[model samples]
Target: MSDGERVEATPIDPPQPLGATGEWLASCREEVARVAAGFQAFEISDEAGYRDAKRQRAALRAEVASIEERRKSMTRAIELAVREFKDGAAEAVAPLSGLDAEYKERIDEWDEACRARRRDELEAAYAEMAPQLVTLVPFERLAGRYADAGKWFLRSTTGPKAMASLEEAVSDVARNERQIGMYGLAPEEAEAMRAEYFSTLDLQAAARHAMELREQRERVRALDAERAEAAGAPPAEESRAVASARRAAEAFIERDAQAPALEERQRYVFEFELSADELMSLMRFVRANGIHGRRRRAA
Candidate 1:
């Protein structure tokens, strides 16, 4: 019969193509992620449930990471296909010509001010520690009595006694220096040593003072280099390390030329100049021989 028959149909969406820019693709991904997260087992109150949740979460995380990598690869072609544009480029460049050097100068001044403040704090702490410094009687003596003792040696039996006192003073000085070196090491006698008057107020204070002193030493190292140059001494030899770092940077820039859109975190990708296998072989080489500027410490 020509009578109308009941019919039902659900509409199916046509396959949509992604745009040339990654921005909209990113938005679409966020919505999909929101929907997926609604079913996640993110909470657990018992040990068994907690263990199960951990494994589930881990699997989900792995999937998420895989998706992120694929997404980057998919959008990379669009990023590469686009040409560079210079909208208002001259306007931006004209106002920023001299700012870099000016900012560097300002930063150096600020750093020096901070260093000066730290030095003052350390100096004040040292001043308090000076009064309680541990030492033998002769080592701490400001009078000329110890000096006279040396000359008085040939006068009588006091010669032997004077020699003994001098030896004692030398031993005391060595012991004090050794103890001072251990100030931050938390030796059993660290507190007891601090009581002697030569140490910083506490272990934490001692460590901070040591770090500041190290930084101060580095500042002097540059001056040392300048002075060495002035004196006509041979410049220090360049270490393999410095060369390695330079090479690493050059390698990165060279790779960037091939894939300017390559994210720093996504260094291993097929979109680069090399095939995945070739890239992986290069990676293995870098891992063993070291990258231009980076080296892993020997195990």
Candidate 2:
């Protein structure tokens, strides 16, 4: 956690300046030039250059160190600016996300309305057929009647009669089709009523299916909401604040981008001079603004 701790070794590169423009790179030009000049002064290329560099490697190292230090400052400053900008951007987009979610919920309600209406229409159609259905016997009832007849026909014979009753079996089944209706239904009407009964059953099934679908959708939405809350737990007001910060930063950044190079440098200096309160505001602004375009564009 120590700020001044040496953590890792890395290759040194020319440092760039931190700003909306390339001025940050320019600021560290002196450090880069000194390193380059040392390499050149020692003629560090072939046998002679290698020998000279090795002999004066200590001096070369000092120059390299200076360049590295300047590079780190530039990198650190730019990172801070970028971090701030993105935080602001995240805040700005949050409100828009909420609006988007509201619109989505409305769409879901509309879809459920359509499904509910369709389900009602099916049930209504089914209800209209109920009167006719009650008049006719169901297929199951007809089967049960046949089953009862079988019990009688398959009865164990008494002492005087030990044979199967063929007459009973044929008679029971002969009237099977006609017996499907409570009233004496003609073949065609009986078939039609049978179909209508099935249609009623189908409607009942469809209504149940629709209800299940609606319930499933509700469950999914609840799960999604829970996950979203757990991820950030951001309240409505907090989200709006982030959104507001993002927009402000974006607007400020746009204006700042148009300023002259000197004015841009002044803004960078202002970053250092920021108070704690101002720094937070700046972080939100810069984060929202999407600074550096390198680390934040993808985000």
Candidate 3:
């Protein structure tokens, strides 16, 4: 029989209530059971019986092919119907979904703008917190110094507490700056002090380090002067005792040079009362020769 006739002979209608679909499927199973029983009972003892069984097997295969074709056609119809329903539902809600997405985009942009504004305000506030004399230190430097504290940033920081912390930092920088100037340090020593202050945030330590550096440099200069004087002095230009004292001082400085850096040095304090001209001359000599001197108020 033709494929169409085979399908028409066993029409598989759309599913409905259990009554019609289940009965149709039951009838198909009954037909298969009858065929199976007939094949099992009919023994192929003769050549004629074998030929009959082979013919029946071909018919069974054809029936299975027809059922498979019908099943494919029904499933294709169901899939098309499902796709159409989904497209219709999505069309109904398209405008609302678009509106939701647009609103979210606007909110995100506004939130980012607020965050940018807050960042700018934080930088300005940090800059205002620095001392006016702290010209060398920028806001970036200050922010980096306190960044790990987490309170210096925009979200967690408060006005009064931030001001207090910044005030402490400003005080430190100001004190360090004053000490740097007060010591009348050489240009190299002043730079070293500034470096130490920024690294350790300690004023006394920076000052003490600069003073030690100054002392080392002064000792070298004093040794060089002694050598130059000894080598270049004219005959009888200095007394023997004075020359011997100069050599002894140079040797003492060299011997203690190998000592530990933290060791205390011998300090000699001299009080001078001089006329203005003499004082000016002395000050000029001290500065010109890189002498380490500190003024003391008389009691």
TM-score of each: 0.20, 0.29, 0.35
Q: Which candidate is the best by TM-score?
A: 3
Candidate 1 segments whose C-alpha is farther than 4 A from its true place: 1-179, 182-213, 223-236, 260-299
Query: Per-residue lDDT tens digits of candidate 2, residues 1-299?
Result: 48788768566443232333366566567557756775555345689778766768778777778778867876787788778777876897899789999999999888677645543443343335443442353434432343344332222423112112223322343344334465444455556544543444332343345446555665666565446544644333334445565566567767767876563433222213322233344444454445543111111
Q: How many steric clashes does model 1 contain?
A: 11
- Candidate 3 Cα misplacement greater than 4 A, ranges: 1-119, 126-134, 181-205, 234-299
Model 3, residue 176: displacement in angstroms? 2.8
**Better model by TM-score: candidate 2 vs candidate 3:** 3
* Number of residue pairs clashing in candidate 2, backbone atoms closer than 3 angstroms, sequence gap of 3 or more or interchain: 19
Model 2 weakest 10-residue run by lDDT? 157-166
Q: Mind sharing the TM-score for model 1? A: 0.20
Q: Can you give the lDDT of residue 21 in candidate 1?
A: 40
